[model samples]
Target: MKILNKTMISVLCSSLLAAGPVRFINPTNSYAAESDVENNTGFNVENSTSTANTHNFSLVNPDTNIDVDIKYTDNTVTVTTITNGAEEHTFTYNQSNGFALLDGKIMNLEINEPDFVIDSEETLSPQISLFATPSDKPVFVSPGNISFSESVDSVGKVVAVITGAVVLAKMIGVTLPKKLIETKVQDALTLIGLGSAIALNTMSGSFTYGLYRTKDKFYTGYPGSVNSYQYKFRYQDMAVNASLLGKTMNINFSEVGSWWFQSKPM
Candidate 1:
């Protein structure tokens, strides 16, 4: 397991370095319409009175502007973008496909299909869609819950102690009482079951939230957005202190980019 983890980390780090110089764009309050993002995600939304069939918006880093334009037709939706007023890029999709993108540098438009239906709120807003930060930085990972390997070690030690007690009891039963030995063995078995259950529950809900960052903004929540590629890493060594829960990761990446986006809130 240790060797496999090291190999995976090496491969991921190599991929990030080879991708290009890491960069981030400044994040601005400028918003992109929710309808444009949802249109690509397959949920039917009533057209905003703001625009009939076309939605035009811009998402900005402090310095760069990502212009987005979406066009809806009978069976398909087309998303177009001009980043910082540079060359245009486009993506087209229909219901079978799951997501749409404005540009790799901007937001990856998606809808929380299951949640949206439950909430029953469809007004155009970022509440249901994922936002993206502009950047070329390959990935950012947030420390998840504590690992349970130590707990397993504790259980093993307890079992060893119980086994030793049982052996000693059997060998010396001529002098020692039998009831005490039976009671101790039963108690040890009970503890083992309880400890195993606790460990399983703790790990069941654990997840590591990751983001890909650029020089200016930390792009998160854009799971399958444009330019988003899948990367994998193990969380064994990466840990978040309880004190730092819900806080922005303030590690290295501070040259021209700031980690204003925190793992907890977003």
Candidate 2:
């Protein structure tokens, strides 16, 4: 079942990519649309209606857009993301001349416990081991970059911590005479003060997300049905904290992408 879903979505997304761009509009607002971002995922809306509410409008593989309203009363979520994904997938044709592809759902999204973790110092890491249970292992070659990311401003952190520590030390009477403040002390202070920064610099995490559209040509499907494909929105996350520090802070993200197949075969 999961396999069928993945395969179907792959086909749908591919159709959007093969044909042309798609549009989504809430009708309540007559706002401008986003120009196709080169292979970028996610979207930033340009709304014209004064009464619009906040929502997330996103596009997935092959090319499909969904508007998720943040509130029930909010009636302004529309506009589409342009897409260009592959339109065809190759399949082997053997003695089985005609195999009808069965009908099945083409999508999946599961954000179980947490495959991601962020530390108190704002370092993020992804645990790749907790991706998906392989009901149907859709060949996960590699999606693009997902924004449930981990980034640190090392320099900014150092300066802030140093200043705070210096103030705290002065308050505690840990001050040495200026003449006796040797370069070695300065260096040692720099190192000890940056314990958190060092953890961040040494920390590593991984995550992947984006529009990945592909077609699965089933030799057994009905005549026109061959044009079908599925749009797949995939994610894999499982992150842990540095051994020195238990998981103190983290950002969790669950994602979705729409799948709608299109074809102009006569």
lDDT for each residue of candidate 1 in 15-81, tens digit (9 for 90 to 100) = 2122212223232222222121112211122212225455554433344443545555543355554
Q: Mark the regions of model 1 whose C-alpha exceeds 4 Å error after superposition.
A: 1-50, 95-266
lDDT measured at residue 11 in model 2 versus the true structure, 0 to 100? 26
Model 2: ten consecutive residues of lowest lDDT: 91-100
Q: All candidates' TM-scores? A: 0.21, 0.20
Q: In candidate 1, how many Å is residue 140 off? A: 33
Query: Which regions in candidate 2 have their CA more than 4 angstroms from the true location?
Result: 1-200, 209-226, 229-251, 260-266
- lDDT assessment of candidate 1: 0.27
The TM-score of predicted model 2 comes to 0.20
Q: How many pairs in model 2 have backbone atoms within 3 A of each other, for residues 3 or more apart or on separate chains, i.e. clashes?
A: 24
lDDT of 2: 0.22
What's the alpha carbon RMSD for model 2?
A: 25.3
